[model samples]
Target: MEVEADEEAALLSRPRARHIKKRALKNKALSVSFDEKDLKDFVGGFHKRKKKRRKEAELLVQEAQRRKRIEARKKRKLERESVYGGAVPATDSGSDECGEDDEQDEGSELVTSISGTATYDNGDMKVTVTTSEISREEDKFPSEKMQAAGTQINWRS
Candidate 1:
């Protein structure tokens, strides 16, 4: 019985040893063939090139940020100049025709026209200027009640 148990143990240990040896041989076979000098040179060159690329990327980002800041400053300057009608001395000559004030006035006029406070008569014979108050009163209440009270009341007083 002792000999039989030793034989079984030997059988199991033999396969494990063979498997380890095969794995070691496979790894050895797959090893890359590079001289020490060549390996070091390649690694050093790769790192140097990587560092240069990273520095270039950082410079590009900084340049973009600078340009963005300059553009924003120019926009703010133009806004200030246009608001003050170029009266401020710090205004740039190139920004004189920005028309920011005209745009604002045009926007206000559009709003007024939409609300019926302003009228546009394009050489037509019949020109009607519908007041906002009248339109609002008519919308809020019936025409008869608005005409009677000169105003509109939605709720009973």
Candidate 2:
């Protein structure tokens, strides 16, 4: 029909929006570029790159924590200095002593000295050790105590 032809002509005559979109896409496509080395690295070194990034982030976090701790210690030292010259002597000095924290962690690095014997039997070293009854109790002496761990007895004394 002539009306349908007129409608088709009107539709075709209108400046198309798809042409603008296509022109924009063509401009962007012309500008886009990819480096071969970078593309290969990204495609092949996924795990290694990820691990390196993680390590770098971890080191950054550790450094931040260390700096924070050092600052806190310095602040505490300044406060102590302002308090009193006659204050109780600290276990350690305020200056960076081996860059360590002041808190006493006895578990990590404390050594102890002991005098004589660490254990005293008090003349009653009664050790009743039954290791699977290696031999029947009847076969062993009644007054004897088993010294399987090489516990020295005063036989020569």
Candidate 3:
């Protein structure tokens, strides 16, 4: 009798439960629509942001170029000092080691003289010359020793 009463009490205290179904709305039915002008405005804003980014990139590039020039000039100064063992003298005239002057004449003077001249009558003529010299001794390859050196050679096609 006590067990039956405990079972009845447990059944009375149990909470009731129910299943609920949620219906999903169609994407096309629920989607918000925008006009052409709205889309154009959004694109325009994106382009403006892109332009600002490009300007910032250009500024970065300019700064990098300036730094590179400064570094190159400093390196050149260091190299000059290292080569000269000290700072260059202020009175030292800047000139090339192979002192080439721009104003110096570089051409040979052409001399003309009235030499003898011959009159020619039109006639076809051809001349050919060939020469040969023979050597007393000729150098030959040391094939016997080269073969004795135990070198392997492979030829394939």
Candidate 4:
């Protein structure tokens, strides 16, 4: 117990250790007073960088939302197309007599066989569709004849 006490006394009585003296000297050097202008000069650039990063983050979030909306629109379009049987006319060669008859006939046969039945909602509701049931006037507004006559003018608001 005496030996431990003497060791403790010796440590306390000694001059400050190297690390302690360095820390004390640094603290004393930094004790000088500074005004608002000095503080502003030191912190000005930090605020500008913070503002730039905040704007960039907001733009990224907006882009993500726009992408999600576009994807949803595309998915809905595909589903609607599937629900309507888009096949019978293609199989019947009498529909459109374009110059390339042979190639079109082969392609039409494949498409007609594949799209024979139109199913919706994972086959929960199944409906047999035929091209004759679909009305051409309902599908296309302002018929080709009207467009050729220049009845509708193109206007940009």
- The ten-residue window of minimal lDDT in model 3 covers 130-139
Question: lDDT tens string, model 2, 20-92?
Answer: 5776766774466889999988887988888899999999999998888778667665554444332523564
Give a tens-digit lDDT track for model 4, residues 1-157: 9999999999999878554577676677546787999899779979888999999999999899767655654554344345454433333444223323333333322222242334333344443332223334445665764564353332222
lDDT of 4: 0.54
- In candidate 4, the residue pairs with backbone N, CA or C atoms under 3 Å apart (3 or more residues apart, or in different chains) clash, namely none
Clashes of each: 0, 0, 0, 0
Worst 10 residues of 1 by lDDT: 105-114
Cα distance off (Å), candidate 1, residue 27: 27
Model 3 C-alpha RMSD to native = 23.0
At residue 143, what lDDT does model 3 achieve?
62
Candidate 3 structure lDDT: 0.53
Where model 4 places Cα greater than 4 Å from the true spot, the runs are 1-41, 86-157
- Name the best candidate (by TM-score): 3
Runs in model 3 lying further than 4 Å from the true structure = 1-20, 24-28, 31-40, 91-157
Q: lDDT per residue, candidate 3, 13-107, as tens digits?
A: 88667544454333334668879998999889998999999999999999997676556545544555554446564554543233343123123
TM-score of 1: 0.35
Score every model by TM-score: 0.35, 0.35, 0.36, 0.32
